[model samples]
Target chain A: MTVSLRVLDDGAWVSVNDAREVSVSELWRLDDPSFCGCDLPDFVVENVLSVGVDGRTVTANVYGQCIGCGETGVPGWVPVGRLSDGKFVDIDRENTVLPVYDGDDR
Target chain B: MPTDVERWKSEVYGTEIREHLFRFAEEGWDAIPEDERDAWFERFKWWGLYHQRNGQESYFMLRIGTPNGRLEPGQLRVVGEVAKEYATGPGTNPIFGDAYADFTTRQSIQLHWIKLEDVPAIFEKLEAHGLSAQQACGDSWRNIVGNPMAGDDATEVIDAWPVIQELNETFKGNDDHSNLPRKWKVSVTGTPDGSGQGDINDLALEPAYKEIDGEEQVGFNVRVGGGLARNEPRLARDIDVWVAPEDAAAVAGGLSALFRDHGDRENRYNARIKFLVDEWGTEKLRETLQEDYVDFELETAGDDLRDQYTYNAGGEGRNDLLGVHEQKDGSNFVGLNVLVGRMGADDVIQLADLAEQYGSGAARLTQRQNVIVPDIPDGELDDFLAEDLLEHYSPEPSPFMRGSVACTGTEFCSLSIVETKNRQVRFARWLKENVDLPEGVEEFHIHLSGCTASCAQPQIADVSLRGMKTRKDGEPVEALDIGLGGGLGEEPQFARWVTQRVPVDEVPGAIENLLANFDDQRDGTETFREFVLRHDDDELADLVEPEETSYEDPMMHNTKRTWYPYAEDDELDASPAPSLADGTPITSDD
Candidate 1:
């Protein structure tokens, strides 16, 4: 199955075409040094990487700015949501409520 | 300095970090081992480089040291050119737009979105203009702060620019004093109003006069230990020792050396010079300085001109250096507000050009995040006022707009929980549109810090807001706790927390109610800060509290008592009784 992904909300949100077959995890990968410090990196989301899918689980490496010391781009693989029969199941941090896809709330 | 921080400092000083930097530049960021990257980043701070946009590995923020916050027009032009070329902004980014540059509170210029690779070239450009980022950050002495209007102020006790420049020259890149327990902040101000914020610095030199050989000589009265942070917020205390103009640098160097050797290194939080001063007391610290480092015999403080603990001579409000004020030479200096100290590169260049065109080839940055264009001739006043740049960087701003000071919030600071720059600007605009203060109240400082680090110095503002997070309807939202009645100068006081958990959306309305209440209830002579101070916490809370609105509950629909009931007697009997089994009524019987 073909999977489509798009970045939204100024790099704050990500949407996937198939929530069931493709899981979403926040990822951080090494960006090109040339693209480094280019204001905004040339990627779907800078510091986030979508690794290959294993069966139904799509792994991603997440790097986020730390709220404690203002350190950013530190890596940690966070399982944002898993796809189960086309339904998105979010497992991210508490209080991080993901938006429901159109016609999927039911 | 905690163990980790101390280790990092030693590694920074011991290791050939410059060599490693060269290697990283040659091999690229990816080539650096993951374990060493953090250390490299820490070392980079010594060179005035920080990962901007909050630790984004790709981009960096460079801070250039400006001794006394003075910059030549040519130097500023070079900075502007650098911003235009390397810096991003003046575009879609909400925080820092295309070619944006910020005038930091330390009297230095900060440019964001700088690439690691472009930094070498930027440094070269800065050096060519006689500017350097050396020792801008790290544990070493940061920017040596001086009164922005030092030489020009008619009320100035002495010109501190020469002393400030000398100290900067002596300390910048000096390895002997490079590493310390923590960052050391120094301020020197000759203005009687204490515009340089001498009391809030780790080491401050305020103007004083003494009779030496029957001649009244101007000198500096030393102050130590003032700092603002979460747990420790103490005002700097007088050390009772006075240094002549020539010995100011020596005294400063002595104090720095004392702190360097004796300051606490076990805990980073307790490592500031303030902590050492607090521990040993100013008398002991002064004795140590006089005995070991200072070669000359220091005189006791005599006839201090500084307005310590008070805002003005009248002791009413804080000194606001905004608007056009006449210099001692009859020329005028115009202080322009740069909203939260953020300025576009083009605007900076324009300011530099205007300074050269209408006045001396100099622009001064104030601690209040404002800039002053000084030395404008009387004949050039009209031309200066008519300049297009003044429209954006207003000399005369509204109370809310003028007093807004925000730290580099979550937008680029990793330690921040909420975005501060845009939020502060929006909030200021909202207050301007909504709240109307009584006449003669044009300056009220409102500081917002994203976290407890207090980089924005919220503790000293007329009204301070520290960032917080609160849940509203089970959804997390940005909020700020309210602090009121805090100020600097003669009567310096840390702000007291009046209320907490004010949601970002409700801040404007809350402030509107508070100010409206103040306008109505305050005595004709009382300032808003005084009004806040005069009232109890409960009273202050009442002023900012949201208006209570009554709404009919659906659960109480059947239980409602009406003069005329549509229900029949049998239907009325089916309604649940208002009284509990113990005869305690749930609703009022009236």
Candidate 2:
């Protein structure tokens, strides 16, 4: 119920809240770490698509609309890597595992 | 982030109501458990914030209220930072979509695609910088707007900004107003030439004076109960009271308090301040306001203060914020147009930089979403025009782009009945691509708003579109309710709603037909506004009315002002009282 996921930006760990499904290549391009530091070892990346709010659990739908889109339907999430021109690049990924935490876990 | 959303365009835009949220609210949003409520709030906030920043969605935009439309350099910088940090990523539509720092017609700054989560922080930062976004949303007293070039304009009868600021402070966070039956709008103008929409506010302070014991007192000619929205878009009726500048804020407070105590709350449809005014009449409301004045511990204006401040429209002269103008101090000022008042943060920072670099650190905002950076040297004119920003913001904007206005409709405002932003963009694009408009049409106003609340002031546009919902093929569909022949400034006329509902898909075609009709019947460069006025509804009904007419004739609603033809020198055209010159420093008068 509680999974600690490392933040891609500065490698800081936070609790995952929820996880939703999203594009895989987009997730990789967004700079998702190859190995997420979680409580369990050998946590498969194929099933660990995204980390949700508290960064606790990994679920199939982690990186889907919630984290990326925020709901205004305008994408607020930024990709991990910077573009050649130093501008922010949108991550193009699908079916990626991520860790998520919910308020109940907290 | 792209979805195979071609079939669900409305869903992509989030224009359709969120049934889940509606159901949740109805079942009782307040009844949800605390932790569960937090989950929903965070989720929704995150969703709105994400899409708002992503720039893919419509309607969930953010507006930073610039009261009296003034922005310090630091505050503007934060706005720029927000835009760059959130809305725009590379290769996407710029944060502004097109323009930058849209100087709104009401002297406010509206930025689109703002996330809800970021809003609290930005608001906090703004407050730290002596700025705030209170009353910027919900049905409350919005940013107290006056002329954009308030103190700078030479023709003003009094320095309206000080009085405007006074009223703003009194009501900005007043909880009594925060939960009113409906939103209340107030406008104050010292100029007598009717430069401000005083007649269309819950309370408007126009220029007027009274005689008491042989002494002239400059003060306000009060009007109350005016409002715009769907079924009730009428101008305020006069209350015949004189309020001094010092007492103006308290008067507004008293009036709002009165409305809060007496306004109906059971039925939302009839819950506006105007309805209360309708129920109580001006005389009775004034009496109530006076009684509340004592309870609120407010002061009244003296006789001499009244004589110096009241507006007299017949006193002479008017300025419509047009091209190439001279300042009273032998300098020059030029009005630029910012179409629809949508601007990017980067562009805004650049404009702010330009204002600082090329001229004085002073810029004048206009009621038209444009700005005039004043005190520019004659030598720098060419260099200023050479900049790429000019191409976008239009230092010398055309009539249509210059005067066009569209409020945040279903996109951001929950009260909207249709999508206004996309429609405005679509309509403007269509006109630019297809029409060959004539010249010297310096000032033609086009306003689009969702529903009638008059957020974009459709009642005053040369051509206005108020949102509507109608059944199409037995299904409820979004549409526009078009009005024509409205004009503001000097001589104001409330536009008459001509068509009840025209389907959204058919709006462009309808506009094309209307424009073509205007061109065919033109009498030499007679601005689109004049042309529309010249043609009666009977004439236009031939062009726009559908063949199978599903509803009653809209012309039946056009009965109020049939015989009131245009009059140039009517008694109502008096000039405002003497105002402080533009850009003048604050006085102890308050």
Candidate 3:
């Protein structure tokens, strides 16, 4: 099941997978480089029902219980990141010496 | 029989009425006839208003907004009349500002046990006397709080009343501002001694030095993204925008519009403008805001407004709502202590009378729950001292009153988890009587909030208390969650929750423990905030409770524990815990 990521200032990750598994730990090996987080399991992917982005920063959604937990930490978004998915991304804050941004900088 | 409005008003009953009506099969106002509608409505409204959480409900509270804690003579008299009418009973004489009114930290009047229906008439009457309750509550700007002693205090660099009035007019009920994606807050300061806590608002304007046209001029150093509620307690982050006074309102309006247009409405939790600012970096926000303001045709202040409004970086160039100080007018300044910002009618009248007797009937409310009576002549200082009100509420106050504040907790707020006013007063009085704080330790704040809503802003207090409930003998009882090391202004930081679930009864003792540590550890001229931050969680926790260092039982079990994502400790084996997710264990407080 797919899950959304909630990133902290220090690079830690928390994801509530579709199978209702709420995992918060250091990043494991990811298939893609840009994502910078761990890979979730297959059964956890089965439970993913829906997802949404929170103001372009964090991703959130509703999902069924994780195969791991007996209905614990199921309904909330655990923070994680997305890889390139065959696309390019830019780091906006790092662009200018002190970036003066305008609308749609996102 | 005709139907009565009381019979139709299902929302009138408190939680207690549900059980009583069910058990006795008793008829409520619902059974009253239509012809007796007005009489029934009056009786029912009175009964509802009279009903306090304790059931005696004898004291009905009416809160009057003193914009940034300012009040005129007539306003004071209005409050006095309300107190005289409500707080007094058959045998009980109202205690002036005690059972009467206690001037609040926020500069508002709150009278207790006022019948609900009479509230409309009371508001109308106050309006007749040149006051309105429109900015009091609900999806509105609320009161615009400025430095209480705006113009009179000699220490200030510039008077903030004009700017405060400007913003209040520009944004208060402006249709452009009425529709917000979430609630927004704004505060302005004329000097660096920030009586206005800068980090707890959506936008904060502070006095800072800047270069314009090759000369140093006073410009507002703007900060954004400060807020407190639930698990999201954060100080305002700095936005690289130094605005002149003339441009302050436009910036305010621009930010308001930005929040209205772009802030999150889908999830109420992520609704505040702070969340949006944090999510979109402050630099990006500033850029967008510039465009927004440009589109709105906001006039950027020319040098004329800049040089005219030079902010005075006065004595010590820091906050001072406590202690006797020299004002710009060359008169003595007296700081009146109002514990927890709960001002009543008699208290308002007394303060107004004192102000008139001593100065020009002008008083300023401090961010701390107290009032500053400035510009008193040397001769009148003696007369000011003779007033009997000074004993209970002193001008020569202690650190507790100078630093202590409590939000309207379970007493009135439907969102509150515990009672705040009585608890804060009890604790403040107890500490003053018992604890002998370090001499010259003029300010030390202790804020008690009813819940995580943080209306009292517990995060900035030297020793902060957030309300919680712990099960004692299988019943939930009120308690406090202790926080340490919050600072405001130039070096701003959010206080960390140090101790969890301290029973309300033990709050005084817990404070005693913390103060005892401060006495031993503090260097010369160190604030309580400095002392707490100097020590880690273990060290701070040890100071609060030396003998037993156990914090586990209270940490996980209590609702007051504000949870956040934590990185797992590598030392713990990655054994999959069954109930929770596989992977490492992480917690909010690292």
Candidate 4:
């Protein structure tokens, strides 16, 4: 089954199969220390640059800043959620410490 | 590969989208297929109907494009009546009430909480009054902006209203120029005061004098590819071509075609003609237009009147279209400041009545999100000014109130991260009550744009504020990035982002401190923009001292997650959306 993924409304949100699944303006904690100076990078998503599904693990490349150090740029692909049986499964992204799939590796 | 938006536009777009829009309107909201909802919503923008943000599912934001912001006799009343009757839903704005109209910076009107079912009737009502939303929001020629009182202003170089009308009629419905690579914004300024802010448009026609047929004739010099959006700001570059008033439409059409054919379609981020201009400088752009796009020879650049331009220049003359200005016909045109550009429907109707009673029924909207009532005779000037309606929408308001401009933020727009209009209104009111301007300083512009989309034109103001986020006491809160010293004039400048992320609560205090620092350290009678230009970025940053003051921001939490920021129960699950025509929520069990 094809899970249609899109970044709509001028990069405001990510839609999986025409349903708004993940949106910008949400704060997430990135486990990567290089992303910012804090013990954990406190990331706020300003724009959903693009989205993809790698092995049912949904990843969103976003453009925003870390509140800890005020560093602004695209910080790799942060996992937002996952797809199960071609259906999007929500994760507690705002509460979890997610790992960043660095652009260097991709 | 083309982006999803490009693919959607390629498949079904432009004027043809209207037929399907009406069909879906008649059949109801659910008639649109679930899988195709995104595509249809994207297409609906061509008709000026934008699907409201995530939680508010079925409602739409309807934008009515008034070419040159010109409202004919009695047309103003029609818009007010439309707002009162149809622009209502469950949510009510705390500041603007349930039904109101927003005057946009590009000289257009927007009404929120519009249901798709009522669109056909609304279109009929709007069409009856010579108003439309066609090509208003999509990738086409958005509302043509210029001096609000183009033909009537006594200080204008030449009457450009007829030329604006000709261009509006030529390209508005023409299929040849209706579909472009990205949104095409055009500005035609007949006035030398630069009220149109032509430097920030994709296509600009600024007044000039050219030697044609051995005589000095007044025409317009062409510029292309200026926009402030997506973290990239560019001033429209001079293309070294000039056009007569009669041939303006041809040149505009040709350039629109040039952008349509050559602009990047694959990457939406790199799609604006500004990027294309950045890629192929002005010389090649002009060469391409002369060689392939146009049939006749184009004239070389003419002598421009840049030295006389001072509207919002952070200097003395005509900072904005506020107060009364003399018209050519021994009459006056009053520029009323609509705070944050949002006016209630009752005020709109009363103003329409006042316009017919005291002046010409014709009204116009300025690029600063204000309104102008033209043709008020000398005898009726005192009476018109005395009207109770003018008290709120004052012609001579405080500089803080008049200079405040904001974009539609998290309230109804999807791309905005924070609440804007109400917050700016609060900021302006507090500033008016608390802060005092330095000696000889009257106008202090502070524009608040919710994001880098730059809809509020934040990059060209005395104080610029864009939405951001920060952690306040271990909780995420709304914040703003502060910028200083940007204005348009003989020499235009973009505001430098001095302070990074200041909490929303501290923004007013930050402004107050910045002003105090300028007062303490600046030379006599130096303007804020001048003061900013004197110092480096780090020095300016030090001047912006963000502290907690008595001014409180009610929306400190994340507003984007809510269904409506002002609602009593604003949680996404508490929304009564995806509803039927009668305002009944449609549940899955239904």
Candidate 5:
């Protein structure tokens, strides 16, 4: 099945299967060089996703090289949408938000 | 009296620690009592485990100590396999997946997303490879650092590898030093090239020679109390004592013991060895060490062979050992920049294979978050260069990328506000593409700290950026404050903050403008730090400030009248009055 992908909010959010599936603030490992080593992977979200729907869950077939490794045409997939409590919920990226700084300012 | 941390340790020693670990592994995080969690976390640090992602304490970060930054290919393969097996890829849960590792400035490996269940297996694997996470963190002596090019460099005053190993064997898992007032850092180096940064550790033993009974003796000159923290930044002071090679480890252990017993335990901030040294003075500390700790009489060193800051075309001052260099043994040691010290498991394994095949069977890590593969024969240097791993960890990197150092940013560190590793990488790439320097300017040391802790050593860079949050047009945004002219060596000075809060988006433009202006107006001999020091603070600030656009007055019909809203009357009078480039002045309507 073919699925549509849209980049929202300046590469912050990724809309997959007509739902905002990932937020840069939530999922991307911004501090880890592997994910955020270069400029935002604009190409990753900008490309279309050929997704497959299985019951209440949807899996998107994503193809792109990691911006960090710069390896292109690598096939990868991510969970785009899932059903929880009888409602479809977009799968948000995890561990992207940092702790608010409350330490000594030097 | 023991400090709170020390007291906690005394109560929770031996079987208690094992019990805590067993409980953590069997029951998982949710089963642990809320009030007892913080203490357990602190206890875990003694085993070289820390909560991953500063504030979010779900998974763990395990630090593996590499003595003097030396690792055999076999040991590295184990670390690589660990990263591939347990750390990398998707996690069991959202909070604990995609394991990766980073090389710390102290020359240790930090692995993230470590679950308690896997800790035992990881520990067994590490021990099998003669590696341990023990004492990687905590109040005990951390990793014993030495010159990464210790035996390889011909200019080295003395080989520090043996001494580093001696100290490591003496201290690792030793309960005598398992608890201290705070974390203790140590470095032992004899590189005459000044690549060894011994002046910034709690105890630094540098190469020194002295005349005794008319015969010159080679040994170490002790420097004590050097540390860098938020409120304290003190270069180590010379203790005026020369130690023989055999007695070096004893001197280090004695000093650590002294600090452990005498260091202030009430105020955590005032508990470093630096504070105690300041309170007792170097003279008293030396006297005590000689009188109380050692069996042999310590003599004062007359000659110092420590490295001094000198000009190097390929090196960043005397402390940097980046790029290719000839060894004393007629071999070549290639220092490759790891770009903020992040390397994948596959890359690590590949590097190990390369090191074993073409060069030595060992690799060394530098405090700069870079690595060195030494003992490459003169004939094999080309083949070593041709290795695919060099493409990612390049020996020949741009000056900015070569000198860029970053702390673990908000990604895994809790104390940081902005993400630093990727941001720093992007900034270096941007600088390389946008800015060009004048002749004689090759290296620009830019250090980025995720927060004020200065783990990246930002205070010692030519250009330092500290992360912070600032308001931009009434909305809060990530930002960094700029510091200039900071450096280390003979005349080390902490950088002065030039701009308080430049928006993260504008930092590149600001740095580019400043560098461009400097390139246009600098003397051929002046280094970037020297050029910055020559300028007035206000002038430097103006050089780096973002560009401002001006609008022409519609009524006057003259487009050349430059506005000086913030310029002082004296300043305007000192220079030519606000006028066009052609000296045309439009009359003010008022």
Candidate 6:
């Protein structure tokens, strides 16, 4: 099974199999201390730089700002969603306290 | 390796895409393979059909590129008819209603809610009336923008209408120049008031004079690699190269070819020529063009007319083309303000009628998102002004109403974070009704762009508003990052983002308070831009006092999460999209 992953529309969206799965402007509760000093950065996803797969979990590198700390940068590889049977499954980014992974491993 | 877009373009792009497009339109929406939808959608932008954002599938925003924004004779009627007939959908905007035409900041017309099935018919109508969408949106020579009053402007240094027409004919569909790493925006300015806004285009040809063998020769001075997008703003750089009016197209082609060969293809974000210019500098770019691209010898920089620039300069002079102005032929051209740049379909048709009855049946769109009716003689000026349509699209509009510009936000664009057009409309109306401009300030520009794309040209306004998100009372609400003191003229300046993340509802109050401060602390008759220039960023940010006010913002919630921000249900699940030819929602079985 194959799932095509790409970021199109000038980083405004993350397209999974020609469908816009994740979009910018969504406020996410991110658990990434490296991105900012805050324990939990209430980050706004401004631009989706790239998307890739780390096993079945779909990860994305996004550019945005931590509203709490007023720090702006990419929050490494945040698991935006999961791929199940070659189909993208949505992550409730608004509710989910998404854990950030070290992006350098990619 | 090339990017997906580059590979897609290599496989099929330019004039070849039109055949597939026509076939798809004829065969219906389901004819397209599901896996190839993204590639096809991206390619469709070449023909000026942009696939609307998520939740709105099978519909497009159709752009008709009227060269230099010139709609000759009966062309405006055709656009209005296209909008009325094909530009409608399940969702209706409460403000703009069922069908409306958007006059873009790029001097083009955009009709939203266009079904793939209706594209052939719409293109047919537009073609019959001498208009085209080819190379309007995608990474090609986009719509050639210039002084809307090109031929008729009394203040013009040279009549650039012929030159503009020649360039349009040469590059629009030419196979060699049809593809590039990024979108190419060109401007040819002949007017001294700097109406063409050449400072912010990929390529600019501003009027200049050069001495050739002891005789004064009229031509254009070249500038390149200027654009505002993705938080990177740059004014076009003077390359110290001038070209005669006859050699303009040749030099343009050469520079474009230079961009095509050298511009970065791997990173779409860094593909704009502005980035290339950053790496190479103006000297290297000019050297490369001279060495490789062109056959003829390029002239050194000539004496330019930059000192005379006034349009959108943020001073006391004419910043916009609103109100009646004189033509070179001793006639009148009326510039009407189309607030937020969206006009309902019927009003569009009516305006076309008025243009025919009053002027030379020609209408031009300006970079300020306004319309100009040219060649109106003194005899018919009074009757044209008295028309009921002009009351709404007024030549003499309030300064707030006159200066309000916005981009298509979450309503249609994928790049947008918040609702823009209607919100700006509401903001303008509220400001017009409630607040007064500080004494002697006739023009106060407030531009609202939905995101970092900067489609509203927010950086060049008195008050710039870019979309963002902020928490209000433990709930996420739509917000704007407010900037101040940006404009174009003899000197161009991008707005300074002094205040960050202001809730949308409190924006009007902030503007009101900021203006009140300006009114109180001015040194005597200094313009708003001047006052802003004198103050530091900290002082300016402090001046922006955001508070709750009588002016309400309907789109406080996350508009990007909705199918249509203005729709009654306004939910992602409630969308009737990815529809069939008859607009019946397509059900998918997994």
* CA-lDDT, candidates in order: 0.68, 0.51, 0.54, 0.92, 0.67, 0.92
- lDDT, residue B389, candidate 6: 95
Model 6, span B1-590: residue lDDT tens: 78889989999999999999999999999898989998999999999999999889999998888878888999988988999999999899988899899999989999999999988888888888898989889999999999988988888888888888989999988898888998999999898888899999999999999999899998999999999998899999999998999999999999999999999999999999999999999999999999999987889999999888999998856898889999999999999999989999999999999988988789999999999888899999999999999999999999999999999999999989999999998999999999988878899999999999999999999999999999999899999999999999998999999998899999999999999999999889998888999999999999999989999998899999999887888899999998987889998775
Chain A TM-score of each candidate structure, as shown: 0.42, 0.17, 0.25, 0.94, 0.42, 0.94
lDDT of 1 by residue, B1-590 (tens): 24545776775652255566666656655565644555566677778887543113356678998888888767778888998888862113444457778887778888876666666678788988889888787778989887777777876879987888888888877777888877889999887777777777999998889898899999888899888864368889999988898998888999899899998887655688887877888788878988998888888987886545344212353466678888999999888989998988888888889999998878888887888888999999998999989988899888788888888765555445455777788778777776787767767778898766687888888778877654445444566778888877666778887777666777767777777788899898787677877888888888886431221111111111111122233142333222232223234333
Residue-level lDDT for B489 in candidate 6: 93
Q: Which residue runs does candidate 5 get wrong by more than 4 Å? A: A1-106, B1-4, B13-19, B89-98, B307-319, B546-590
- Per-candidate TM equals 0.78, 0.63, 0.66, 0.99, 0.76, 0.99
Worst 10 residues of 5 chain B by lDDT: B552-561
lDDT of 3 by residue, B48-95 (tens): 221222211122344456666776545666666766665432112122
| Residue B200 lDDT in candidate 3 | 75
- Chain A TM-score of model 1 versus the true structure? 0.42
Model 5 scores a TM of 0.76
Instruction: Compose the digit string of candidate 4's lDDT tens values, residues B182-255.
Output: 89999998999998899999999999999999999999999999999989999999999989999999899999
Q: What is the C-alpha lDDT profile of model 2 across B1-590, one tens digit per residue?
A: 21111112213222112334334434432333432332333223211221121112111244556766666545556666666665431112312353233445567666553433244455556668776545554445766766555565565656777888877776765655655655677777765446556666777777666665677766776778876664467678766567767777777777777777787665445667788878888778777777655344322333222222211111122324545555545455666666676667677778768877776655665565667666666777678767788887675665457557887654334344456654676666656666555444445556897654567878877667876544457443455667777765444567776775676666656666666666677788675656666778877655554332212222211111111011121121121111121212223242
Q: What is the C-alpha lDDT profile of model 5 across B451-543, one tens digit per residue?
A: 556789888887889865444574445667788888776666778877765667778787778888888888777777778778888888888
Candidate 5, clashing residue pairs?
A26-A93, A27-A93, A27-A94, B54-B414, B87-B99, B91-B97
Instruction: Point out the higher-scoring one by TM-score: 5 or 6.
Output: 6
Q: Candidate 6: DockQ?
A: 0.81
In model 5, what lDDT does residue B83 have?
A: 83
Better of 1 and 6 by lDDT: 6
**Candidate topping TM-score:** 6
Docking class of 3: incorrect
Question: Model 5 misses residue B337 by how many Å?
Answer: 1.4
